[model samples]
Every structure is written in C-alpha cells, then in structure tokens.
Target chain A: MGLETSKDPFLTRVKQSEKDTFMQKSVAKAQDAQWDKREAARKELGHWQDWRNLGEQIRQHVIKYLPDYLEEFADNVEKRGGHVYFAKKDTDAVNYITNLAKEKHVQRVVKSKSMVTTEIDLDKALLKIPGMNLMETDLAEFILQEDDWDEPTHIVFPTLHKNRDQIREVFQKLGYEGDNDPTHMARFAREYLRRDFLQADMGITGCNFAIADSGLINLVTNEGNADLTMAIPKTQVVVMGMERLVPSLKEAEVLDNMLSRSAVGQKLTSYCSFSGEQVAGESDGPEDLHVVILDNGRSNALGTPFESVLQCIRCGACLNVCPIYRHIGGHGYGSIYPGPIGAVLSPVLDGYEKFGDLPFASSLCGACTETCPVKIPLHRLLIKHREVMMDKLKTDKAFNKAIMKGIGMGTGDPALFQMAMEFDHSATLPFVSKKPTSVENLYNHEGHITHAPSMAKGWTDVRDAPRPPKHTENFRRWYKDHEAQKGETTDGE
Target chain B: MKVVVFSTCVVDLFFPNVGAAMVEVLERFGCETAMPKKQICCGQPTFNSGYVADSQKTMRNEVDALLSVDADYIVGPSGSCVNMLHEFRMHLADDPEYGPKAEQLASKSYEFTQFLYRVLHVIDAGAELDAKATFHRSCHMTRLLGERVAPFVLLDHVKGLQMIPLPHIENCCGFGGLFSVKEPEISKLMVNEKVDDVVSTGADILIGADQTCLMNIGGRFSRRNLPIKVMHIAEVLNSNVDMSRVRYANEEELAAMAGGRD
Candidate 1:
C-alpha cells in the first residue's frame, strides 16, 4: 500500500491489465465522459491558455521558493496553536502519526481521500495499533477499504476499475441489501460513514494547498467528507506533500479552480475549506491540530530536471488523456501515481532501479502535456526521464542500450543508412508472406513481413510491417528519375 | 519558393510513395522542391528512446545534410520527424558549432500541410477523391508542431473527398518509435482502439500527416483484415488534381493564419 502497489514485473502487470476488458472499458468510458466535461469547463473560462500560464507561473514560483513558503506555513500553523511536523521520510510521517495516535489513546480514526496518505502507507501503519479502528470517508476510498483495501486505479476515481455490480457486491459485505444503483449505494455508504464520523476521535485529511501566508490548510473535495473529518474529531491531523504549499490564499483560490475543472470538470469542488486550529470558543472543531509536511523523496526532484513534476496538483487530467493509461490503467505503472506524471515522478521519487520502466510505458504522445492545466510538459519530462536513465543512471538494459547505439551509428552515416534502406527489402524477403493477405500489395511492393525475429517481432506480432522499398525503386532513386524527366521537358521547352 | 525536402527515414525506405506524393503536391503548388539525399533520418528513433549521446551524432548529420541545400524553406512529409527537427535546436543548444544550424533548420522546416497552408498560402491543392476518408491526427503534429488547423483546412479543400471526423483523434496511435517494439503489448491495444475508432468513422480510407501513425494504424487495419486504405495527407492532396481549381489564401487571411506573420 506504499509507493509500489505491485511487485510483479511491468510487462506482467501490463499483460494482466490487457486481459481486464472490464477495467479497460470502464477507464475508456470515464476518459470519454471527462473529456467533454473538462473541455467544456476549460472553454467556458475563455483565455484558458492565459489561465494555464498563470497557474503554471504560480506553481513554478512557489516551487522555486518552496523552502521559504514551507517555513512561513509551519510558522503560521504554530501561531494558530497547531503542531507542525516536517517528516523527511515516509516512515517518519507514519511513525509520528501512529505514535501521536497512541499517546493520545485514540481508539477510532477516520480519513478523507488523500493520495499522500496512501503514498506514505499511513493506513497500514496506523491500523497496526491494537484496538484501532479506521474508516475511509470518501465513497470511492470506502469502497476500496471495504473491498479488502484494493489499490486505487486512478488518483481521482480510485474505484473506477470497479463496476457498479462490484460495488454492490462489496457493499453487500457490510450488510447492505440494496441493488447496484449508484445513488442508493452512495446513500448507504454515506449512512455507514456517518456512524463513524460521530464517534471518530481522530481525523486525517490531505492538504490541497497549504496557504503559507495565512497558515490555512486548503482542502478540496466533491464530497463534504473532508469537512466531516475535520469537523467531527477532537484531534485533527493534516498530511501534505511538501510541494503542495502555495504562496497565499489567492494562489490557493486560483489552483482550486484549476484543480476542480481539470480533475472533475467542475467550477469548484463541493467543499472547499480553509481550516486550521479550533477557536477558543468553537464547539465543533478539533481542539488539537497536527500538520505533517512530508518530503519523502520529493526533494529528489528539487533543483533537478524533474523539479517541474512537483507542480502537479494531482488533478489526474494527464491520466484521462494518456493513451498508455487508457490501455493499462493505473496498476500497470506499479506505482501509486500513474500515467505521465507517474512515469516522470516515480523514477525520481523511487529511483530508476525500481521504477525505470515507467518512462517507456508512454508512447511519447504528448496528450498528457497538452491536457495538463499547469502545463507541466509531461511527455517532454518522460523523454527526459529516458535520457537520464540511459545516459546518466545507466539503468536501462544493456541489450536495449546496444540496439540504440547501433541505431545511432547506423543513422549517423548516410552510407550506412542508405545500405540499411537498400538491404531491408531483400533481407526481409525470406520473412515476407508470399500469399498476399486481404489487400493486394499496392503499397508494400516487396510484400509485408507478417512475422520476424528479435526487436521487429514485437511489431510483426501485431501487424505486418512493409518491407523497405527495393534499393533501385526507393524514394531517392525515384525522385532523381522524376526530376530527370521534368528536366528533359523543361530543357525541350 | 526553393524548398528542400527532408524525406524522413520512414518515407525514404518504407513509404517512399508518401515522399513522392509530397513532391508532386509541392510541384502542383508551383514550389521548386529538391531532396537533400544525405538527410536520411531525424534521430527520433534513438533520441526519443533515451539515447541522448548516441543520437547526437545522427542529429548532427541530419542538421548538416538538411542545411547543405541552402533553400528558402526545408519541409518534410512527416510531422513527427519535422517536430524532431524542431527539437534539434534545443537538443544541440549546448553545441556551439551546430546549435545555430539546428535552429536555422528548425525555423525553416514545416510539415507538408503546414508548408502548403502557412508558407505557400495555398488552401486548395485542387485535389479530388470520390471516397469517404478520416484523418488520424498524429500526436506530434497536433501537440508538438502546434498544427491542428493546417491539415484539416487543406483536407476540407480537397474536392469530392468526404471528410469524417475520426473519433478520439487526440489519442496517439502508439508508434513511439522504439516504444512500439519495447511495449508492443500496450502498443497493440492502443493501435487496436485507434483502428476501432477509424472503423467507427465509417470511412473507406484513413489518412494522416505522419507515416509512422499511418503505418501503425494501417498495419493494424491490415492485420485485422480491415480493408481501410491508409494514406498520407499529401496523397489525399495530390489525388485527381485539376490545376485550374487550385486556390490560395488572401493576404489578410494568410497573416491571421500565421499568427500575424507578414
């Protein structure tokens, strides 16, 4: 339940995901539905690019002075009668929160949807205490919790992989006799979470943006559960990735708009709360507040080429547009973060040794970059990751590196390239199918290679590759002949 | 205009017809075009796969070969390769010798449709094809080259061609050079989805600006035994041409289309 959701090889996970037609269909449906809504929401803003530029500038500025903002934020939280803890490691965060829970003698704890919490494996850590009962308040998180703590396939729609019938079956475990109607099931979940909300002695929520100037913790949610998590408990703890800090409430307000539109295609989330220490006379708010600012490999990206990755607001807009994510879903990444963001970030946060292949998972399509509200250049970052892996880290396999080198040497010399072009047709002749398939060999003059060996097998396995044109009939030769004919006519005229 | 044709490796070897069609189309527009023979590849095959050091030599070779012709503009049939040329300036930014050359090549380079509309000011290539066609917008063209309008505008001008909007045109065809080979499983699934969308458009022919996408999508169509003819945008623009029907953009319209370029 940490950064890695699976220990299986990437290709193995991809193979398993490819077989998940149901999950694939669900993800595609969600993406298609979100596309219209997200586009419409963006277009309604008018000058969306300017807005994006502003959002990007704000994020970049904050990231540039992250430490200063974090210092100001921690100071403000302290001034507001709140305890601030900066945990450099994920374990530091888990240990601190768990120890705090034990010291307070808390028996029940409830949580709202927070990717950082999932990232640090906090739920697993806290549940280890004896007699501890924890409830996930978000409906999707609750569904996952009820389903034996299944990993989220998406950052926003965690349970997107699960169908309504699956949700119904999962809910049936909690003694709900209702059918698979989403609203009814949601109602049943709300009622179930309401019981825990009243009794929960401790509540944990993730920060949307930590407003440094006011020391307010910004929480955005479609559901009001985060409010409940903050409102109902006597002890409150907020977990945030260190990069989630903004300069002020104004910036937070701007990002809140961008996040909601990009994440769920809404103008604003249903509940956008900026809360901190309970007032002296307040009756309902938490008396004790704890804020855990977690670095946990985030600093690995700071001052590096990957620094822009922290600019992400966890909108998951990249996932909705990524063709790779479309086919394989989240688990295919093997990291808690998936899609283009994950492809770039996982290697930085978790090192190339563990998450190197995530970069190659993308088709370098640039959809993620195009769709990013913050304009993170997700696809370019993916390529950067690959460059780092191959040139600096030397994490890629030797065979792959050798092939790339061979390609480089081959392409660098025109003679070698011409030779490759000339030889390709005859070399592939043995593999080319003699009997034509559906269409005549109109385009493929030398026939298509339906099957091949080594690297090309991957291509020929799925589709026939046209053999390079015969050397005598290649484009350059043909062009030279055509130009000669044109020259004859011009000279005669 | 004197233009140099940078026939990408894909077109030079595998799909020469695309390169040929591009030449014919350019000639039809009255632009003098010449092929720089040494411009063999764009280095995307190695560069995008993370072979930065290894690809530098290939990239340098390309910049040298492309700039050797000394033409008014350099153009390519494939947007993906053209975008790679655009990337060369940044990639070679540190190289004091070739940095300026790379930038010059990038500035002059354009994809076929972009060159036709933006540079040549021609909207109609006087092409006609009596069939339904859907265009698979290559990812590099739309996103990297920032050319979403050029291909569509030119396709709209192709007389007798019924253009249907391809469903989910924003998605990639999954031919990320080596990515196609490295992750064929995922690539297969993605390309299959593309094929489904192409079929959904109910078009007999699928056209695209990049041959790489066409090859991947067309390969899938053929592998699945779907008889959808795959074509480059140039081929569609070169088909059944009538010289008298060709049209060009007015000065104001051209200025607007080029974002105020005079």
Candidate 2:
C-alpha cells in the first residue's frame, strides 16, 4: 500500500488509535503487566541504573569511535576464518548478499528476525534471484510473511498487535490444520519450519551485538530458531547494522542483561547463541560464515545530535511506554520501525522528506525518556528533529512560517502580546459553538481559523477542532477593574 | 502577604468565577491579592508545540508583569501555567540577562493549593462545605509540579465535604491545550474516561486545579446532560456562595448568577 493512501494524515492516526478501545485495552493490560514484571526484574537484578549507565557509556564510546570499532569488528571476524563484507548503502548491502546467494546457487534461505534486512528489503531482493525461497523462522515474522504485504507492528514482537484469532486466520489461510491454542499454534509453526530448516541452503540472521574481543556474533531469541537456522544450513550470513557491536564480551554480557530486562522483562531469553566460523571439532554449525555489516545512513549520525539513537538495543522498551504508540500502534508510522525510537530514528535514517511528520506526532510528555534504559533522551531528540525540520531543512514551508509568526507575536513586545491576548478570545468567538463545522473561520480571509487548515489537515481528519472562547474579557483587564473598585493601590513596587 | 493572581486566560474568558473564587479563598487565608494588567499567557501552547522561540516572547512579558508586582508570591489557579513558568526558567538558563529574572519568577510562583499549604502553612482553612466531591489530579500538577498532597490536605479539612476517590486520577484528562482540538477523538476518549471515573465516584462535584481540564470535562458534561457539577479547586474552597436563594438547578443556577455572581 502507498504511504499516503491512508489520507487521514499523521494526527488522524493518533485520534484513531485513541478511539481504538480494543487496542487501548490490549495496550493498557500489556503495559501494566510489563511494568510490574519490569519493576520486579529490575529489583531482582539490583543496580540496574548503574548497569544501564555502563551500557550507555559503552555504546557511546563505540558510537564515538564507530569507524575504529567497525574496522576492529570486521578484522576480528575475518581473523576467525569468517568472511566479512561492509555495505555502505542499502543497494550495496542487497547486492553483496544477493551475489553471495547467486554464487552459492542457493535454492532455499531460512531467515531469523533481522530489522537491518527489513530496512534494505533484503527478502524482496533475494526473491528476485531465481528459485530462492526465503522463509522467516521467527514466529511473528512468519505470520507477517504469510499475511499479504503486512508490516511488523513492533521491532521485537512484530505481530504483537495481532491477537490469537488473527494469527489463527493467517495460519488457516496458509493451510495449517491446528487449533488456535498458543501451544498448538507454536507446535504447528515449529513442525512446518523444521522442514524448511532442513531444506535451506543458506541461513540469514541479525546480529544483536558482534563481540570484537571474542570474534563471535551473538543472536538472542526465545524460540532458538536462529541457532537452528545457523546449524542446519550449509552457509550462514549475519546481516548486522554497523553500530550493533561491543568492544568485548564483558560489555555484551552487560548489554544482553539490559536488553532482556528492557525488551520483554526477561532475566534472560531462551537462547543467546554465539557463532563465528565453524571449527573442525564442531559437530553442528554453518561451515561458511559471512558477517555483513550494513551502514545505511548510520555513519552520518556519528558525532551528530542523533548519535544516541545508535545506542538502541532494539529492546522496544521505548515503544512499550509511548502513549502515542499505544493509540496509533505501529502500522500508522508507515515504516518497518515504529513508536518513540522510530519517531526519531526513521526521520534520521529515511530522511525528513518522507518521515518528517513522525517527530511531531508525539505530545513530548517525556514518558519515553523516563523509561529508556540506555537514556537516549528520546523526547529531546524529537524536539531537535523539529528544530532541524523547521529551521535547518525548512521541509514544510507554510507550517514553519506560521509557527515562526506565532512565536514572533508571542515573544515580540509586551504591548503586542497584551493586545493579542485582549483580542484573542474575541477574535476566536465566531467559531465558539457546541456544534461547529469541521472547518471554521476566525477572521475574514486572515486564515487564523478554529478548524485544522490545509497543512494541518492531518490533525483535523480525525479530531474535533476546538472552538476558541467567545469572550473578550482578558484576565488582566478584569483584574484591574476589580482591584480598582476594591480601593487597592495600583502601583505597589 | 500580598499575592499576585495569574488568573490564567481560560478562567478569565471561559470561567471567570474560578478567578472570583480564588480571590475569596485567598482573602480567607489572610492574603491580599492583585492581578497585573499586562499578564497574558505563560506561552505553553506555543512552547509545548515546539515553538520555543515564540513562547519565549510571552514568557519575557509574563516575567516583566509579575516582577512589576511587589508581592510575596505569585499564585495561579492553573497548575499548567505555573508549571510552564518553572519550565521556562530552565529554558532561559543560558541567557545571563534573563537568568536572575527567571530564577525570581520560579521562586515566587506557586499553584493555589501549593501556596496555601507550603507558603501559608494552612493545614485547615476552617471552611464549611456540605457535598460529596472528588478531585481530578491534573497531570501537570501531579507529574510536573509534584504538588499531589496540597489539594488533598486542604480538601480534607472541608467541614461537611465527603471526599471520594476518583479512579485513574493521575491520567491526563486529555485537555492538553492544543492536544484537545488537535486530536479530539482521543481527547474525547480520555475525557470520557475521566468523566466515567468522576461518575463512578458518585460525587456531587468534580474538582481540578486547572480550568483547561475543567472546561473540557465540564463542557462534555453540559453537552451530554450529565448531572455532576465541575468546579476549580479554588471554587470548591470558596464554596461559601449560598445556593439556597436560587430556585434554579442544573446549570440554570450558574447561568442566572453568571456575570453577577463573581
């Protein structure tokens, strides 16, 4: 589906999400459960903040020296008899991976969950090569693969928005004969994926954090599908975002702990598999291991205001706590990523022209900032995006101009400020009604209206436009008259 | 002590009696109140919307107006604006010229109940009110200003008032200035939830520190023909206004005494 086909603009999605009672109930229940579990998990772990601070410091150090880290990471992997490829862009990344599949003449590719691959649309790219059957091993990704053109709702749990009934429908459509029970569903998916794992020529997975010191790529998952994919296949390719690395295994251990707690409130996931090149003594592992470090616009963020965005461990903790995402869900964001981190990262990675509206979608309530384990300052970064969009990029001309004018009038002179205040209530009175039209005029042809205007049509498509107050008694004037009548002295200071 | 009342634009236009009640309540606590004529807005509408530059102009004007008054403290019926005043001081931190002015504004300004409890140290004002009431904790006051206990402290003292607990009291009433109109459906949903909470309390009146929330919730009540009354915290505290002489009930009482009551 085209991005703009929704027609209801960005704010409308928020309104729609707000009114989604089903989604709200699900989100509220999930949040309560997750928060309780998270609290307990944090208390259990002890000194979570200190650990988070260390994780943040490590990530920051890595990002600051990203060039050096990337080189060190690739060198270490190569030294361990693993092939390494650096893809500067999406096309380059796809080209390198596709050429590898072509050279291998791979018939079937079993894939684990990898957002970097999704970012490059690598599955679609792989399909272009003849007879390349790409099967998603992750349960959520598998459901998305079966559903026609459906995107993931969340990074961690891509199918979190979908309930069991929806999953049952997807399974039924995919010709699965099983009960809708979660255990039965898992059994059916497992039985079905086990066959594909056996037949697959190459396995592709995402690296959570490539440890430079150990020359090993770590994959964390609950299902152990990544391990199965890597072990059963003849060749394995790990496509990772360049920033996803730790200098040593010690830092990886710290990060894995933080990631588990923040992502899904787990003490640890079911599997944390580390594999590089298969050793001679190893009984089960991919013989040819190729680690693809994809740097698609991430290099640009280094030393920039958005450097903290790279520290994200894909925990989805920020998304879980986001009020805006709670309502709009993920699909509304029109990207592979969604929620608070997506609101910042999408615009940076995808450019402001396509996703600039994402930053303004938030109320800047700072919930994301408070909940962020790595302390990314998600809300402040969003504001910084707005500043860049309005001042530096000047993407939306009319909106920026209006905002600038509004700011100017508000901050200019005391007399102007007083006069505007005196007139504001009266000026907006025409549209002040219990039932007004979707759009209404504030003044004759001046365009200061009650309804959402053309550029702001996104906001009004789903919300009731507020009717400004229909009275002219500015508080200052009322106070003056009341004080004068009370025989109070006018100028005390 | 001389107290300057920042009556807030919402109360001055849409709900004037909130200002009147504030004055009355302040006098009962033995404080003289004044309203500066040059005051406009705390510039939250622009500031929260990412128009910090524009909001700064209004902030400077507000600082100048409040500074002109030689009052002991600046008290406002709206916690949102007072919170904005505190937020604005931090925003002006880099400027050496406005740094002291921002500090002065921050030190002097207080939300009404906060001023009553913290500044006046009035544990009980010895007022009498006979009705069941539930307090709606405004998000700005609870989360931003951290003034959760002050309102309850004063409300607990009302002679005959039965205070009921409102469910989900900490949730935003969905009256975020631009947020209400900008996303009305969700805004309505949030407010509806708040209304449900108030109705569940079985209280005769719903009280809040901010007029913006009261206006949104109160308007919904009026539109839906809900019987529960909505009042600012100041109006609840200044509940000495006798309703016995008025034959009108249900908004008619309010309309009859509208301009003259204050």
Q: What DockQ do the predictions score, one after another?
A: 0.75, 0.17
How does model 1 score on DockQ? 0.75
For model 1, residues B112-159, the per-residue Cα lDDT tens digits are 899888888888889999989899898888888888888888999888
lDDT of 2 by residue, A55-111 (tens): 889989988888787888888878878899888988898899899999999989999
Give the worst 10-residue stretch by lDDT in candidate 2 chain A. Answer: A438-447
| lDDT, each prediction | 0.89, 0.75
Model 2 chain B: lowest-lDDT 10 consecutive positions = B241-250
Q: How would you encode candidate 1's per-residue C-alpha lDDT over A1-493 as one tens digit per residue?
A: 9999999999899999999999999999999999999999988877888999999999999999998999999999999899999999999999999999999999999999999999999999899899999999999999999999999999999998999999999999999998889999999999999999999999999999999998988999988999999998999999999999999988998999999999999999899998988987776678899999999999999998889999999999999998899989999999999988988888888888789889989888888988898999888888898898888878777887777778899999999988898888888878888556554323568477789887888998888888777888889888999999999999999
The CAPRI category of model 2 is incorrect
Q: What i-RMS does each candidate reach, in Å?
A: 1.4, 6.1
What is the overall TM-score of model 2 with all chains considered together?
0.83
